[model samples]
Target: MERSETTATTRLSTWRQVKRMKLLYLLLLLPVVQLFIFQYIPMYGVLIAFKDFKVARGIWDSPWNNFEHFRTLFSDFIFLRALRNTLIISGLKLVFGFLAPIVFALLLNEIRHVRFKKITQSISYLPHFMSWVIAASMLVEIVSPQRGIVNYVITLFGGDPVHFLASKTYFVPMLIISDIWKEMGWAAIIYIASMASISPELYEASDVDGANRLQKMVHITIPAIMPVVVILFLLRLGNILEGGFDQILNLYNPLVYEVGDIIDTYVYRVGLVEYKFDYSAAVGLFKNVVGVVLLVTANLFVRKVSDHGAW
Candidate 1:
């Protein structure tokens, strides 16, 4: 009888706590519902990957093909080349692009002038809002060998104009540099917020020890944000195959396909253009499986080292 009373009291306490936070929970409902509808429901369609998918038969009625597409995927040179390019681009971006935000955040944190810092941050943020279509078009104009600003500068230096986007020599670097330019500022916002939450008392204590700004930042700010850095890096590692599809699709041409083609663009041509949905789905599912493996592995590694992870 006493145990039953205790259980009843615990249930009542839980109900009261929920009632107190009811509005907040209500606010969370929309996103949870949307995720179930758009994200979770669509996952059922992934079964088509293992099936001989047909438009008429639909995802459920499709006959099971059982890894035939995957077999073809492994043998195909075109898919292999796309996979190679995707890894190379994604790896380069991970190195440069991931570091960019942390560097930008640190630089912004150093600026003493309020108005100037705000203006600089605002300008950096603008590129992230622009669509890749518009941004890539502008980028093309900026690098055009015939009449672009970059070529104009080269000629000013008595050098012949270079086709930056077309040449494989310049293509990977261009992609990495452009990606850094587009994403660095927006990604830095997370680091900036992490920095903001750091106690000012830590800096004040460092000042008393005769620490210089660089020393204090090194010891205090960077260390304070290491967890955030570790978590972000782990997340990036998980998506190690996500070479920027829209950006490359817009900017790259046939000339640079050897260096620029990625799984996404390859999938686009196969699925949408050629109407090979099953093959495309299999490739996508393969990429996603690889990503999940990487994510889990990275998470485990980070947790072991620093005790910081997505969990």
Candidate 2:
């Protein structure tokens, strides 16, 4: 009888605690509903990957074709091309785009002037706010062979005008450079915030020890923010197969497709434009599965190397 009374008292205390937090729990309902609507609900479409989906039959009535779509995707040369380009572009971005933000943050942190630093940061971050469509249009105009400022400058220097966007040789480099420009400043914001959290006393101690600016940066600043860098790098590895779709779609032409086409663009062309929905779904599912695997592998590697991980 005494043990039962004790149990009832514990239950009453738990219920009172939950009742006190009811307002906070109610506030979370919207986000939970949004997640269910936008993320979890759409996941049902993954079944289309296994079905020969027809508009007339609809998703539920569509006949299952098993692995036929997967076989078709593997046999297609274009799919292979898309896969290869996706890897190459994503790898290059990981190397260059990933480092650009870190460098920018370090340089910005070193600036001593307040007004100048604010102005410079504002200018750097402006490009990130522009839509890819607008940015790509501006780039196209700037690189136009006939009337562009770039070509005019080339002509003034007695050099041949080059069609940068159309040429296979230049397309990949342009993609990498433009991607870095678009995202660098925005990405640097996280690093700058991390740097701000580091105690200023550390830098003062380094100064007292006769360390130069570069020395303090190397020994203190970089080491302090290395955790953020590793976490971002691990997250990027998860998207190794996602060659930026919007930027590429806006900038690419048939001439540069050999080097510029990626999995997302391929899906757009084959799925929506050509109406091969099932095939596209299969390709998407494959990409997602690979991404999950890569994310898990990268997280494991990071956990082994350091204490930090996505989990």
lDDT of 2 by residue, 1-311 (tens): 99999999999999999899999888998999999999999999888899999989988899999789999988999999999999999999999999999999999999999999989988888999999999999999988999889999999999999999999999999999999999999999999999999999999998899999999999999999998998899889999999999999999999988999999999999999999998999999999999999999989988998888888
Relative to the unseen true structure, what is the Cα RMSD of model 2? 2.4
Pairs of residues clashing in candidate 2: none
Off by over 4 Å in 1: 1-8
TM-score top scorer: 1
Candidate 2 achieves a global lDDT of 0.94
Q: Give the clashing pairs for model 1.
A: none
Per-residue CA lDDT of model 1 for 170-207, tens digit only, reads: 99898898888888889999998999999999999988
Top candidate (lDDT): 2
